[model samples]
Target: MRVAALWFPDWPVQAAKLECDDELQEPLVIAAQHRVVVCSQAARAAGIRRGMKVRHAQAAAPELTVIDANPDRDGRMFASLAGSLDDVAASVEVLRPGLVVADLKAAGAFHGGEDVALEMLVDAAARRGIDTLAGAADEIATAVIAARSGQVVPPGESAAYLARQPLAVLTAETALAADADTVKTLGQLGITTLGELAAIPPAAMTTRFGVHGAHIHRIAAAAPDRRVAPELPVADLAVAITPEDPIERVDAAAFAARALAASLHERLKEAGRNCVRLKVVAELETGQRVERVWRTREALTESATADRVRWQLDGWLTSGGAGAITSLILEPLELMAPDAVGELWADRASTDDARRVVERVQSQLGIDAVLQPRLIGGRGVAERIQLVPFGEAAPPVEEKTWPGAIPAPLPARLGGGIDHPASRVTLIDATGKPVIVTAEALLAGEPYALAWGDKKYLLTGWAGPWPVDEGWWASDANRHRVARLQAVGREGGPQGDVTGWLLVWSRRSWRVEAVY
Candidate 1:
């Protein structure tokens, strides 16, 4: 069967770029254990290369920014690309972060032909700002070689094409990297070339290298026998719980979710499956229902699953959801075999400590105090994270366009936010003048400082004075207009205390909205 190999050259660097809100200008490289793993194009031009010692790379390009290479982050980011490929290909096998092999005939036929299919897939990658290189051939190995060397071998000419290539060519694709070791072994056996290795009888090769030897023999002959595997369809596996009495207490709801999650885990394990995506459903006594979906790239262990369920319940009950839950359900939207997922392990001590704290907090304070905030985007700091009782639905913001919605890298704050009712702060412009907004959504001036209690802070860097005209066309005198600013500062001057703050202009004056 014809197959195609697609390569993403610098996936780790690309993932970092996507996660960063600020545009990275300096040359950057991702290094693992003092060795360069991947480098930006600019870094390459500055003499940085993969596998180079990090110290040498840095010394060569002093301004190069180094980022740690994280396997988890790479895998998580690649899932989106894999999902996109799944839509257009009949079968796709992920080799690693940067390489995937797909059934070319099927994807090609679906898009009307091979070239058009590659174009469509390339366009899909471009939509996500991913650069990709692709090539096709009759066999998987040939396809991989073609992709790396920019060749499209003829259907029946894979053997001739591969025979002419050096053994080191195998190192270019992740799928063949492991087998490349066998190539090295073959070198020891006085067979350093593909044609030389192919002349060895299959039985002798197998005798020398076991199953892998037999596999490499076929590769040397340019005859690949492999099929891409498709992703498993999501299964709807659900388990529900109904308490005899309405579950009013946070502890009671948390207990119910924990038990249900454990049961769901056991059931799936018995069936040799695991869940990565789940939906929580809660039905309240007042007839209100709440639902939310949670997903992770890694497989959810029993405790992790329960924690999510408990968090959902906590938000529901604490948000003045007004009624106790009558019933709750845990359902898996996506399922896969356990081995297929990578389970991220956390330290047991820290995990248990965190669990104890959440439990103790819910017991001592009232449920409202043990709330969880749902992260979202909005024009105002107050609208960015909606605090609901730990297991409840967050307060819904209107779906209309938030013209002045702040970009990410949101301000960070603790305990009831910046307007915490127990603290106060003032927003001032660069001239040490109070910042304000007029009725027309116009800012009085750019914010440059903050005055909180007795500590004075001077702004260093900032963005906005983003304007919002909400309810501006109202017939009555209820029209409202506001301007928002995100300013960062330090306490004594530009060097004392560094932090980020969100400031808002409304009701004719400005106030500190949140601290980050």
Candidate 2:
């Protein structure tokens, strides 16, 4: 496998430098949160190194320009840079702010071989105003080291090339190991050759150096090359945000969400992919992280993304005083081709319109005021319907047509004195005349009289007493409930339009229930 590694050097420091020194091409060092993160090639030449405190770096090169680390800015820039490489590499895997690995076996051929591919990759990075080193090898780890150290070894020679490298080359040296008495540098051990290290008995070595040492020995022997194939094509990208200051309010989640969504959009566009699901992880500065996912057909518009984020933030803020949001991560769960289209035009249009209305209403009233009615299958009218937030996906629609289904035009709501069974009343006219309703009469024609509220009215039409018995399992049982109606002349006169009909009770003291 022809593998290539793109090393960022000190990405955090580089990212910081890109921030303040737009014209900076000279040696620079950047420290953030008091830790030295990067040293420019110039600084390196001047004996300034990464991980050196800003103070020490300055002592080494008094003219060294320093920058503060900003992860968000760095993440965004990294994403943009990654986006630019879509045409060059078959696949791009970002290791951090500054480093990325690209599968260049085929890409090298396409670019006219290894040397050309290396030059093109370097040129691409330079075009983005970022400095990078590219190295190719038969193994990814070897490529990574070559890129870092600017050493190139041909195929079938990786192990031979790595042989002369010291133990430090394996990056296994630690502060404690440096101070320990087993003080043999890999070079000093005469195991400079990877083959020599591989010749060590694995079982015995495990007892001597533990698993990490055995692993390092394997890597030195180039074991990973035999196992590491070209990586699978990446589907989506993710970014996490950790605020410097703790967020005390939930509203912070919204801001974080918006930022993450925008980043996701940029990444998807670069990959030539469209995402249908976005997973948002909002972490409070105080260490509370809540994750939620939203489903959508296209990348959410910036404003819409912000709105949903704001909703989530506000919910958290109002529900509990979360410390500031410390971090936020957005992940794509589902990917579709960038050009894919959907068939639900009408449904999409209506949903979009409804969303707008819901937003407007939520802004006018409190967030809790707007809700979407969800139909459920049950006996209790209240239980049969539920209200959920508008943006949330609606619950599945039930195909339940209960045996004792209510009338065709069921009232949006039902109300009366108190909810109980066995209540009765007589039907009367507008003039308070009682009209007996038999089963036959009920079906024949609309009853003329129905009394309610100490007054009588003519019934233009009548419908169900569709009895609904809810809470069957409860200790207290329910009774039969029915619905009937009454009508009347307008306030103007008989010549005036017929005032809308009203739902009237069927038993003894009739009461008006609804107006149509």
Maximum-TM-score candidate: 1
Candidate 1 lDDT? 0.70
Q: After TM-score superposition, what is the CA distance of residue 334 in candidate 2 from its true location, in Å?
A: 16
* Candidate 2 wrongly placed segments (more than 4 Å): 25-27, 33-35, 45-47, 50-52, 172-196, 224-516
Report RMSD for candidate 2.
23.2
- Deviation in angstroms for 130 in model 2? 3.6
Global lDDT scores for all candidate models: 0.70, 0.56
- Encode model 2's per-residue lDDT on 175-233: one tens digit a residue: 11121212244456666555666677877666765544566666667665521222234
**61, model 2: CA deviation in Å?**
3.8
- Candidate 1, residue 369: Cα displacement in angstroms equals 39
User: What does candidate 1's lDDT look like per residue over 1-516, in tens digits?
Assistant: 878888777778877775573365558899977899889888999999999999999899988899998754565456445546656775666555667777888988888988877766666665344567888888877787788865778789887877777776665555663354566777777775677777789999898776568877788788656565533355656899999999999789768977897788777766767676677778888897766555543466666677667766765665463479999998887786644212224332234334434533433343466677776656676766766766454555556666657776766664354445434568777677876666665567776777777888887887777777677679547775666777788998966969777766655555577778
In candidate 1, which residue ranges exceed 4 Å CA deviation?
Answer: 127-129, 177-181, 230-516
